[model samples]
Target: MGVTLKDVAAAAGVSRSTASRALSGSALIAAETRALVEDAARRLGYRPNRAASALRSRQSHLIGLVVGNLVNASFHTIAEVVQRRAAAEDYQMMLSITDADPRREEGILRTLGEHGVDGVILIGTGSNAAASNALLSGGTAVVNLIRGAAESAAPTVLASDRDGAGDATRHLLELGHRRIGYIGGPPGTNSGDERFAGYEQAWRDHGLPLDERLIERGPFEPSFGSDATGRLLARVPEMTALFAANHEAVFGVLPALVAAGVRVPDDLSLVCYEDISWLRWWQPPVTVVDNGARELGELAMDLLLQQLERGRGSVPQARNGRTYRVGAQLVQRESSARPRDV
Candidate 1:
């Protein structure tokens, strides 16, 4: 016969009940005893009968992670961190991509709920207000990640994007770049709006006019960067610097800048709204506003787990409502410099 719980307990020199408590992650069991039982289970190749365990616990031991776009660098890191955190608690994570499509997000939310996910962690603005409200009041634990107060009704964790963007934009202004071109995601998304607010706030604080002619708004597509940058530069020839709202757009902006004969920190200084590793190695390393995506993911999942552990209203909230804001910082690199006189 294959190794069973009894066999594992016998090997660990502990009573069956003690071994069971250890294996079940009961804190009442001593740490040494838990380690010993885990070691025995590993050596004996003892696998718990999940079906029976599920019947006893009434939990699927599964979590659903929903993201607007999988290809986005930010979501990729977030998903990785979520999976790792979920697994540590003996919970498995299931991923769903909505492509930021409202209808698709709506359908997927229903699907995940119907499939009996113990909890959900969603990124970006939810699909529809009705659906979001339904799920928020549906009594299932849900933690919204990466969205701001305007989009979230339940517990949420978000990057301090407005502050990050404001800081980066201010840096460009400080470098004496009078004409700064801005490229970002469409206006509907709370994230995009907040970032734009940061850019606007910086100009307001510095008593500078934000030239509407230099701003480009589009979908969060890599292609958008090139298309918009080309158009912006062609129209506003005096524009000396560019700011992109997300990492994917940076890829698009670079090729367009190259084609236009613009040299980083020479002919045209540049800064990115989002930071990723490869940017550091670019010929003139890019300056960026880096909000720790991985940390955000970890903190978000931890909040969801807390909700699951104690049910709704267990997680703490601020005076106004439920929101956790992760901070961001500006990374200065060679990509930014004072504008050269046209």
Candidate 2:
């Protein structure tokens, strides 16, 4: 049987009331008495029941972490950080996955509220604002990760897509590649739109005409990337380079290139976002835009704790909303080279 408070009290020769105070750090006990209780707890290997403690305090100290699309390695990296951060602060996590759908996010939030999570940390784009509003209405603190545009005034932490995309575009432009193609993420996702806008802005800044025929949008699936790549190649046969929005999208594009017998870097060079573990280990090392995902998660949890302590009283600066933008950097690799003719 597990050691209990009664065992600890008995071993310490102290009253139950005194033992509880010593263990919970609630009331201040004498130094001698506290020492005795600590010694007894250590000797007896006493473990306090967290559920019981939560019930007595009416505070779970548990954050509901609802993530969308765990298939994306970056999200998993963020989750690892969140779990560690929550534990460091003497809190727990109630995790959920919504798989990139707004309706599912609504259901997950409702379930988390019913189960009594202290706060919620959402990691995705385009969740139900009504559902999040409902969570706040019930006095639950919320934070968003990897989401730039949101309806709620709640704090959000997003990857810096605009500048990262522009950097990628500039790299290609400097390589003397005039015909560049882009494959973007889902339409409603803020990151997708911002990245697409950045791509366009880079072209304009370089005095290069925007080619509507070279752009395509789809789900961030490998198959969609392959299809988009094939379509872009057909429409703009002279295009010498491609910029895909993500690693998964690149997965699709690479296979399509292989099937068509298109030589990489020689026929077409590629720059993509995200470098998964296996990616760098593969044949041609892929050049990519790597945002600090673990840092993003840690910052989001920090913001959630801050918002919870603040209790919606103060308005955050910048667009009159609570939001955070995590910066990203481009990783150059062997997959991209100077244009064939150059």
Among all candidates shown, the one with the greatest lDDT: 1
lDDT of 2: 0.80
Cα lDDT for residue 166, candidate 1? 95
Taking the tens digit of each residue's C-alpha lDDT, what string does model 2 give over 68-165?
A: 76667787888788888888877788778877777888889889888767888887556576677677767778887786436665677888888889
Cα lDDT tens digits, model 1, 45-103, are: 99998767776876778888888876578888998898898998888999998877878
lDDT of all the models against the reference? 0.82, 0.80
Poorly placed runs, candidate 2 (over 4 Å): 1-4, 25-47, 311-320
Best by TM-score: 2
